[model samples]
Target: MSKFVIKDDFWELFPQAEIAVVVAKRIDNTEASAEPVRPDIIELLEKANEDAKKFITKDPLSENEVIAVWRDAFKKFKTKKGARCSIEALLKRVQKGKEVGCINPLVDLYNAVSLSFGLPCGGEDIDTFAGDMRLTVAEGGEPFLALGDEEYDEALPGEIIYKDDEGAVCRCWNWRDGQRTMLTEDTKNAFLIIESVDPGRSGDLRQAAQKLEELTVKFLGGTARIEFMNINKKEIPL
Candidate 1:
């Protein structure tokens, strides 16, 4: 089993945070149509959009509870909001009348689960990672390649990131994924992460992770494994 570690620095700052990690292996990895969106996935996004509109109507993006937690995190980590987290980005798109569209089988499946649960969910090709994975505050100058970018960028000191032995895999927590580990049509092994700051929402987190596992296995033909971690539990074998 591979190991995934959350550093003490992160727990000390956000003790209430929780994360669900889902690992899938033996995936089909063959190219397939990600559209038109499946009926179940469409329903999930539609309902999530309705829920988001309710709170967004009452307050600005930074003030919305679901997005606020992440905004606060970004502030603590010395980064600005807006493009700080995946969930916030998705919510903003829905607020602007843009429905989340399918990207690929794996991406579409996880996006559905993310919107449904109102959390930041992301994944990477496990094979691209070097050695074990760690979630920690960067010390500065770690190499990172944001999705769709041609050049490498340096991660700021004190910013939270997920990294492997070679370099950073994700920067600013779930804000952006490094290009090297991005999931693609040839991804046979994947590591999916669902993050939540609400302490009382563990049940929802577990359900969302399980749903991702089910969807991945059903659509991508993988064997799924899951692990849960939080301030109370620091590490898990993947």
Candidate 2:
């Protein structure tokens, strides 16, 4: 059976960390690849970019609470050079007066929620995962082909990763996702996550999960269910 499991190895690093999940089924993402982006989705992204500025309390991006928390977490594990949390990537773009562009319907919607909620949000195609999905520290050398890369790379030992029976699904926690299970226009069922390393932001993590579910159901025509994974709960069947 396919399930998403957070191994104890990961919890050993950040015991109080919370990962919020949303499993969406029966989605229609064809519009994400359309030439002219839907006007409503465009507005949603624009507002989110503007709203994200509230979290930018410090001049340097690293000083912000959300960015700093992830930065500290990454230091506990090995990661690729220059890899930063996905939320930092999005917030950086917004901080520089640049808008986070749309990728696909599901991606754009999650990016919107990520920006608005100030947490790292990501998703993958549920059908593409090989057997169960796992969150753990890599033993090193799990084959990985990142999004838009022609050659394959390997996950570093001691790095935080999400992997399946086939290979690595995401590397360095939420920094980058692999192309093997990437969400695309043809995707119908999706598994989404919003991660929080700081215990103080637990409320924000939960709010992001709800907002993501609302947007996925409203725009993608799906039945989305939300779940929280922590020390007490570690797995959910896909």
Candidate 3:
């Protein structure tokens, strides 16, 4: 059995931070990815886009509380020159009045929850992971083939990353996902991650996790278990 471990290196930076994991199994993520998107999923995503606006009160995007906290966190470690957290990317689209399109059932549901809660959320195909996965600072030179790209973008030393024995699964924290473990319509088992660095948003974090868990099983026909971790609870079976 593989395990997911959050290293001490990560906790040393943000002691109050918490990570929520939703292990979803036996799900069908392909139904909504066909040529025509499902109406219910579309409605869910549209509402989430509108709900995301509540977190962006500042005129300038970066000045918002949610975006600012992540920006400051990125500065604490080495990251790619222009890399930004996933939440920033999603909220920016909402700010521009651009709706995020549906990818797959599982991805769409998680994205909706992420946007609605204003937290960084991501996932990986559990079956694709090489071994035990970890959230830690990279040692640099770890292999990373970004999604939709043909080349490798190696991880930088001191960069926060989610990795398995094969190499980097996600580079620059949650900024990007590597193709090796990215979620696809064919994926049956998945590892979803909802990250919270702002201590004040702990309530939002739990709510987001619960929402994601409910959506996963409802739309995808699966069983999901939610796990929360902090400095004290650092590991869980994957």
Name the runs in model 3 displaced over 4 angstroms: 32-37
Candidate 2 off by > 4 Å: 32-37
In the order shown, what is each candidate's alpha-carbon RMSD? Answer: 2.4, 1.6, 1.6
Tell me the tens digit of each residue's lDDT in model 1 across 11-126.
98888899999999988655544334356555665676666565464457767887887777777784524457888888889888998885667887788888877889999998
Q: Write the per-residue lDDT of candidate 2 for residues 78-135, one digit (tens) a residue.
A: 9999999999999999999999988888899999999999999999999999889999
**Would you list the clashing residue pairs of candidate 2?**
none
Once fitted onto the true fold, the runs of candidate 1 whose alpha carbons sit more than 4 angstroms away are 33-55, 80-83
> If candidate 1 were superposed on the true structure by all CA atoms, what would the RMSD be?
2.4
Candidate 2's TM-score reads 0.96
Candidate 2 global lDDT: 0.92
Residue 206, candidate 2: Cα error in Å is 1.0
TM-score of each: 0.90, 0.96, 0.97
Report the number of clashing residue pairs per model. 0, 0, 0
RMSD of 3: 1.6
